[model samples]
Target: FIRLMAKPEKLGDLREPRAYLTTIANGLVSDHWRRQSVEQTYLDALTLYPTEHQPSEEQRALPIELLLQLNTLLQQMKPLIRSTFLLSQLDGLTYRQIADQLHVSERTVKSYMAQAMLHCLRLKNQTDN
Candidate 1:
């Protein structure tokens, strides 16, 4: 239990150690399955491309990992910031367009985008370290 070792505080007030460990184990299993699903979806999409256009396995790993990291980051973000970031990055929407869609001002859209970018940079730095 690397997690338990790393965060020993989690065990501080445990009335049932078995239950606590089981919960952690269950969460790890769920996370494993979720990661597998994401990887599978990526691999499946790659199959639609011609063999000649396909990436090497080495190349594919990077995007899959990045996708997983991005997924985690988005999940941790505030809902409005997440929506704003997705609209601009994934949907190729302009700030004005996103602002209109979200019923916010253009300045507010810009602020949200800035916050999202800062969050991304912070995550990147953490991973790098």
Candidate 2:
């Protein structure tokens, strides 16, 4: 990790090496907790989905490659754009409704949706090839 952070000479010159490492470790730990929380929330929400409308076993079992590609694509989007996409697709919100909920203009909501769609389409194209 030190080698990854900087050259050895620069790494050795840090006045508070313990503090530096502590900060990095804390950040990594916090990110892990955050991801765990998000995964738990997603799993919990899955129980609320209507059984009649739920995806079939095959549909639910997306290839790991495609899942990773989609995750990468979503992570690259701005928070607002990602939220807009989720609210529209997952929550079944209209553009106007999302705009009102997000305190943004309808045009902004549309723009965010377009940005998210383009990102997903690009990812899909890459995965398809």
* Winning model by TM-score: 1
TM-score of each: 0.77, 0.53
In order, the Cα lDDT scores of the candidates are 0.92, 0.79
Candidate 1 lDDT, tens digit per residue, 48-74? 999999999899999999888877899
Candidate 1 lDDT at 93 equals 99
> Which regions of candidate 2 are displaced past 4 Å?
1-67
Candidate 1 residue runs with Cα over 4 Å from true position: 1-10, 15-19
Candidate 1 lDDT (Cα, whole model)?
0.92
Score residue 66 of candidate 2 by CA lDDT.
49
Worst 10 residues of 1 by lDDT: 1-10
Residue 4 lDDT, candidate 1, scale 0-100? 62
